[model samples]
Target: MRYKRSTQERSLTSPARTTAPHVKKNVDRYGTTKLGKAAEKGDLEAVKQAYEQSPDELNQPDYAGIAPLQKASLKGHAGVVAYLIKQGCRPDVQDDQGDTPLIDAVTNGELDVVRILLKHGVNPHHSNSNGQRAMDFLE
Candidate 1:
């Protein structure tokens, strides 16, 4: 069966942007901040600029609670993921769906990303909200 996109996924794919007068403004409308989008797109220079401006952006999650590292990992951006991890982004942080970067890597068949995450000590046995472990998705 085909699963529908989660709220987070929907946000990730959307491109609409809006700002409220009394609320904080987001960097983008895709459930991500500027840094998150940069990482997802594998724009190393943008990621570097964002990081240089705010070191905390490396660990900060977007509106959907998906961190820059997770976005990079999900998109198979090994360089971005490695850079974020080096900046102290935790690889095991779970999104709203409880999927870690390692789980995302495994789900997307990102062998290189999976290896990078593993080398950084991301837990291999951790399960997602669906109770599926990273290894369960392996070929």
Candidate 2:
């Protein structure tokens, strides 16, 4: 015989989910960098300044390996994502957990950002360390 679960029982039995370790480190690192700040704010000018002063910053990841593209994409900054891509940023660049900008945009429900990332040829089939794809995050 099988038993149906009560609402309280169901809630208690559900597994607790947490952000990956590197993702938290990425967040911490992002809040302290000019490029990460610019990307989070969608500030193209600041981004350009950072890039001009050090082109390598574009590809520079936080200690946790979150790049500017990932930061911009996570914040739903379509303009920043576009400009970064135009300036040679790789859309498919992944964080330590294998989460790409496309995954970030999709997870955030940023449709415009998703379109921009897709236009840049981000792989839709890519999965993160948890094995979740961009589509998995879609409503």
lDDT of each: 0.79, 0.77
TM-score for each predicted model, relative to the true structure: 0.79, 0.76
Tens-place lDDT per residue, model 1, 26-132, is: 45654466788789999999999988876756666766778899999899999998888888888899887889999999989988999999999999999888998
lDDT of 2 at 136: 96
Candidate 2 residue spans exceeding 4 A from truth: 1-32
RMSD of each: 9.0, 12.7
Q: In candidate 2, what are the lDDT values of residues 1-139, reduced to their tens digit?
A: 9997543311111133233333333334233356676887899999888777656567666656688999999999888999999999888999879999999999889999999989878899998999999999988
